[model samples]
Target: MANYNPYENMLQTLDLAADTLGIPRNDYEVLRHPEREMNVAIPVQMDDGHVEVFTGYRCQHSSVLGASKGGLRFHPDADENEVRALGAWMTIKNAIAHLPYGGGKGGIKVDPKKLSERELERLTRGFVRKIAPIIGVERDVPAPDVNTNPQIMSWIVDEYSALTGQWTPGIVTGKPLAIGGSLGRNEATGRGCMFTLLSYLEKQGTSIKDLTIAVQGFGNVGSVGALLMHREGAKIVAIGDVHGSLYNANGIDVEKAYEYANSHGRSLEGYEEPGMTRIPNPDLLLLDVDVLYLAALENQVNEANMKEVKAKLILEGANGPLTKDADLYFFEKGIPVLPDVLANGGGVVVSYYEWVQNKAGFYWSEEEVNEKLAKNMKKSFEEVWAMQEEFKVYPRLAAYMVALRRLVEALKIKGYNG
Candidate 1:
């Protein structure tokens, strides 16, 4: 973290993927830089009669595929570099999911939890007003990310609609169902992780019921992924949050952990079970389990801690959970990783479906949505797996190869329109 830059990390992976794919540097040099980056000043009036100004950013990595799409988060560390990296990753994620979209991401550097509901709404509206000109239902769409959720998405939809004077739900996804949100949108990312893990196990002639797993991060994506894997009969021996980690050698009751998290502001700080043990946040990844579900943030498992990871497989539940060096280390160690682009793509895949429903005024049932998500995630995994086998490369590079190849071909077919 002392010298970690998310955008630089993204570029490193992009370069590695391109080099492995044997594509000309010119073919992907464009991806090294974002197409556009928008930073804005958001001024909000607090309940105490004071004005606080917040800095926010939105970056569009590419639009060669179609309109740009990604999530927007409110975090204390949100900045241009992080947003740029996230947007670039979104491009590859969309490509791997085979969706007609590019990548974009935005976030304000603030803790939303500290803001009152009214104040948060004002901040949301203010951010939308500044980014409004460049974003639209067909141009760019933003959804919720860390410390953001459906209620916040509803605010985004309302503000964007008010600015355009039209009820355009397509401008955002992951909304409450009443506002044209797709069913299963909330748990789509986690569910997609579950599907990918199951698919991997099925391919390996193994059973999920016998696996011991540890998860880092107990928020939306992490908790949902934990619960789904639990349903599959996997032993979730450890789980963690921003506060710290929880472990039970036999298995932690994911249901109780999840319920407690929901009841306590998504933090696992005070959670306890009969045999549960509290460990340092860093220790969660070192648990000698069958799988390490990295659902936290960037730079968590870089060189400083890569050697300590004992999981045989990793499911990237968060974007950039493993840095380039850690990722390559795992690959060299013969550990299989379901990379973020292919692993956590369920959120974006279902987001695409939500946008489609909004465009058609037709929504899907929860069962229909889950089926579609599983099918898409499984397909992407299989494609990435095939690429891995064909090139003898790690899953992450293989996934990037698949996505980068797709983007490059699209560029070749489109050629210079100028």
Candidate 2:
């Protein structure tokens, strides 16, 4: 992999996109840095009477468009730099989707799987209590990511509301539907990714059924992405998760894998079928698939493995999956990569819808949510595609340019410079 740091790698792309747009340093220099960063120490009482202190971070990258929006991740590898980069990505993602919001991100350093259910609940509440001062229905909104889910968001809503003595579900998104969660929010990211890919293919006169897809990290994003592609008649040749990966040339039943992971507590360990062969995680990246879906961690497609990636297109289901060097390598190879900002913007789009519904006391049906998502994703893909064609640059850079241009225009309209 590349030796470059994740934050620095993101900066490299940002600088290039800024240069491509010819934006002056004075115009977006502030965008290069976060608006605020809060680091908190969360102490949780374990069932064994042990007090373990965990480090947590909340970074607001920008609020020029509107309130900051992003997700909170619980992982052993969560760090300030990763949180910062992810926060910045949320800004770009929202702008690319044409949402009226900037970007923020939160994370806690813990292996969530190691904690008991009670301990997990306690930790979630503790995080909300610590960040309560800065987050709210109109401030920074937090969603789910990585080890976080709707349950965690429900805890956040309950803690924040109990502290303030009001029922404010808008303070968080991705909650359970029984609460104030939006319909179609769970599958929004993957569905958005597929929609963008489909739009791109349509412009190129290609179809999904003609593609062979290999997906990495079969979590919420990957599993859903593979299933959607399969539904569209694509051949899902390989898939993987945190445990490992599996491949089959004829196609590895995505429906079977999805059911297996669901029943087996979100795992793919014992998945099997005829013609299926288990492969290493990295091997999934090098597979000779038409489209490679990356829904795992960042820096997965770094310099070390860039040369081995044989896919014609890369759909980033994870933020910052390809390092700067790897991104450049793909550009040199003429491989089209739909950057995470545009590829995985579905979650934030629906999150915005949820916020709107909460504010207006009206909700949309699942069909309405999916239809609106498709419309926005199609428009974004077309804009980015046009920028790519006009600038003769990579898709990621083009996407950044599209988002940056919109952000700069918004800043100008708001008279921020004055």
Candidate 3:
């Protein structure tokens, strides 16, 4: 993993997909770089009256399909390379989901957990103010990712609206419901992963009830995903968060666990219940379960631990959870590793819906939002599954092929083929 670069990982996948598609280099070479990238210095006034400067980045990978769309992550490890890779992955994700959008991503290098509420608000507003010139409903739209959430998005909308002197809820997504957020946005990513899993299992003539699952992250994506899968009659045997891991061989009560975490300061540090036992976080990955869901950060399943992952089927809830070598290792071992571009696309799909509703000034009911999200996720899974079967490649490579084909066609139509 010494030479592993997220951006290079994306490019390597793109090259493999292009080669498989038999596309000439001239038709797809332009996609190797971002269309535009901006680095800004954001100055915020701390509560103690001292001014601090922060670095932020917004990278638009492509706009050939439409205006760019992605998320803004607030994390200490965020950098130009990671942001660029995420932007490229967003482009592929949108294309895989068949959404009319390109790919873009932005981030500020700061640990949001360490900031006070007021300081966080000031930092979000400052970052928005700096990127406002390039972002809008018709230019680039951003949603919440990682440490960012609906509250941060609401702050951005408020700040952007104040600066422009107009109501533009469509300029950003993942806002609070009171401020034009979509009804089903919170659980969209997890629900999408669930739908994809069901689709794959159905194809294999397996029932959700027959599977046991272990989730490697208990954040919004992991917790919601575990709950939804449990609702579908799957046995959730184990779940873990950054704090620790919990296991119950007789199946954990996902709903109860979710509520417990929510009420206990958004952590599972001390969650207790009958039949549950504490385990090491890494041990959760090696659980004797039928499926393992990776909803944590990138590179969690790298070459070092590839052989330790015992799940027969792996689904990604986070972006780039598996390194390139880890993915290939799974493929060689005949373990199916679903790609994030297809598995976690529910969030972006609903973000598109929110953008549509905001533009139309009409809100959709939760039922409507959920129905449409499920349909889109199923369709995307089928397409990627078919591609994998046709190419005899891993799901990750197949997803890249599907997305690259769509992107290359759009670029050709725009006369960027040369």
Candidate 4:
């Protein structure tokens, strides 16, 4: 409903970050544009014998640090420019997380909910076939985003392997554990979000048990984040998905809601519990809670509804949840936002570990993987927090500073820019 362009949002953030750093425009102009953008048409044969062509886009924003790394989203709103913006964010995210990778993103313009399982599989294979030439273990690796999941990544890995006549589990991440996936892969993002939140709370001298949380999106990230927060003694008073939003004055039993939604194919439409009242999803955003988690689609928090936000802290569990204009609005209100790069960077952090394991032909135990991830995430968080304090800027811009600093170094070393 908002006339926001995500790419323009990204550029504004980049421009502000550059201005804060006082870097000349000529030094980072190359990063303002993607290195490569590929748009392809996948014509698939439906079970009814009709040919349907779906538009797909893959954008490699940068590769100076390492192979291009990002997720593949399947949604009706996906477009070339959106994918381009997401790819650019991927680069910034990896850099801020201090990962040895660049950024890329791809998406297909179709609502997976409208397609049957067979049709989804066919479309996945078709997409893999189309993009196989540009993606691989040492090249651009794709993971799951939006409506896509590990099963979709599995299909891509299988289809790409079939085309190349080899087994390369490293070619794709977020795959099921049966196919060389890493331990703690499923809950990595949510768990990492919890970790970062706790870490920030500790730094702020606030007790997690005393806070209230309102999560917008009961999907993988939000559900797990809410559940984890509940376990930590935080009261979850509001939650919502595409179905609707639900609130309880006391607290909704997150475990029960998760079970109901999981058994019902990830829908919270008819979920019933004591003290539960149905409300609009937008209303959930404005709920009075200490922590507001955005785990839904992009533009969920924008300029139009920015005035309604009531949370003191925002954890971006989803990518690009806050547009630039909305972010500035929140910043002016003294509401600190933990950007997606620093919050949701956990998933890709562990994905990089998975890739290393797959390449070395050895894997780490769950404890080892989690320990390594925690170390990396904590380090990244500390760096961003320090940057925020030093620059007297918002956390999002501080995160971009962390990433841009690293990226400029990489570019200098690569001789792309001096």
Candidate 1, residue 29: lDDT = 78
- Whose lDDT is higher: candidate 2's or candidate 3's? 3
Per-residue lDDT of 1-418 in model 3, one digit per residue for the tens? Answer: 6567999999999999999989888999888999999999999999899999999999999887888999999999899999999999999999999899999999999998778999999999999889989998988999999888899999999999999999989988899999999999999999999999999998999999999999988888999999999999999999999899999999998999999988875688888889999999989988889999999899999978889988999999999999999999999999999889999999999999999999999999999999999999988998998999998999999999999999999988899956
Lowest summed lDDT across 10 adjacent residues in model 2 is found at 1-10
TM-score of each: 0.97, 0.98, 0.98, 0.98
Q: What does candidate 2's lDDT look like per residue over 1-418, in tens digits?
A: 4345677767778888888889876777778889999999999999999999999999999999989999999999899998999999999999998888989999999999899989999999998999999997778999999989999999999999999999998999998998889999999999999998999898889989999999998889999988998999999999999898999999989999999998887789888888999988889999998999999988888768899889999999999898877888888888888889999999999999999998888999999999999999999999999999999999889989999999888888877673
CA lDDT, candidate 1, residue 322: 88
Give the Cα error of residue 53 in candidate 3, in Å.
Answer: 1.6
**Model 1: lDDT to the true structure:** 0.91
Candidate 1, superposed: residue stretches over 4 Å from native: none
Q: What's the lDDT for all of these models?
A: 0.91, 0.91, 0.93, 0.89
RMSD of 2: 1.2
Task: Kindly list the per-residue Cα lDDT of model 1 for residues 1-418, writing each as its tens digit.
Answer: 6778988877877888888888888877787889999999999999999999999999999998999999999999998889998999999999999999999999999988899999999999899999999998879999989888898899889988988898999999999999899999999999999999999999999999999999999999999999999998999999998888888998999999899999998988788889878898878889899999989887788888899889999899999988888888988899888889888999999999999999999988999999999889989989999999999988888898999999999988888322
